[model samples]
Target: GAGVSQSPRYKVAKRGQDVALRCDPISGHVSLFWYQQALGQGPEFLTYFQNEAQLDKSGLPSDRFFAERPEGSVSTLKIQRTQQEDSAVYLCASSPRTGRKGYGYTFGSGTRLTVV
Candidate 1:
């Protein structure tokens, strides 16, 4: 894929269920990011991986949330013990890690996770 790809475009999870959301960044992209977007709100950075090295994870809500980019090209965000408060859209984005502005990353359509 030429851009970020996310699976399970929409997921409905019952309370206490665990779910894994997948993301495949553009080939050769060194920077991969995971974000959480609450309804009507902008995406909030969840974690970032720079070629398999997780550079930041401070946005993870709790220990129950985890994200990894084992290959640097693909990533996954997993949520445990799903709660209603966890309902939101999970987004993935990829960049060149150039730290330069104007080169916006490519973002996936996002996975809409709904917990009930």
Candidate 2:
């Protein structure tokens, strides 16, 4: 019954560097999602996975951003060649099903990445 959790709630990276953030979803949840939220903006879907299968990733901004859920539970988001524009909050959420409209998502506090 653990809740979603993310590490390095804050991260500072230089331009052209790579960073990897980690997420731990709730146990028994069938769906996991990653989202990017800019300052004062709503969270935008980045990718989603059901168990170990990545069901959707259309929201990934670019090829530089990659994610994986190899074990069907723990997921990671890796950013290659970080840029100033990549600075934003990376959120991880998990739900009981694909239709999260009612059950909603349990989001981690988020990893705030700052690029300089």
Candidate 3:
């Protein structure tokens, strides 16, 4: 595959709504990461996964955020009771491995979520 792919390039949700974003990583990628980028801010790491196992989720803002990769390929980010502050671009990135070696990440175009 070319790189990480995210669906529904843009989404609009009313306050207190629930939204689910999807990500499709490059084929055979072993590592995946999710990040949130607010208006002019940089992307903040939300979670990481190696294969089907979630390795880290320390950056999730609240319990309303959840992510999963069941088959080690496709992943989903779900936000419940979305709020206005939750509006941002959700990015998905994938890499062959996580290490100090010459590894690089491929990021998706990101899903822009708007909460009204």
**In candidate 3, what are the lDDT values of residues 1-116, reduced to their tens digit?**
78789988999999999999999999999999999999999999999999999999999999999999999999999999999999999999999995777488899999999999
What alpha-carbon RMSD in Å does predicted model 2 have with respect to the real structure? Answer: 1.6
| The 10-residue segment with the lowest total lDDT in model 1 | 96-105
Candidate numbers sorted by TM-score from highest down: 3, 1, 2
| lDDT, residue 4, candidate 3 | 85
lDDT of 2 by residue, 71-116 (tens): 9989999999999999999999999885636788899999999999
TM-score of 2: 0.94
Q: Write the per-residue lDDT of candidate 1 for residues 1-116, one digit (tens) a residue.
A: 77788998999999999999999899988889999999999999999998999999999999999998887778989999999999999999998867656577799999999999
TM-score, prediction 1: 0.95
After superposing candidate 1 on the true structure, give the runs of residues whose Cα lies further than 4 Å from its correct spot. Answer: 99-102
**Top model by TM-score, which number?**
3
Model 3 scores a C-alpha lDDT of 0.95
Model 3 residue pairs with clashes: none
Off by over 4 Å in 2: 98-101
Model 3 segments more than 4 A misplaced: 98-100
Give all candidates' CA lDDT scores: 0.92, 0.95, 0.95
Query: Regarding TM-score, does 1 or 3 come out ahead?
Result: 3
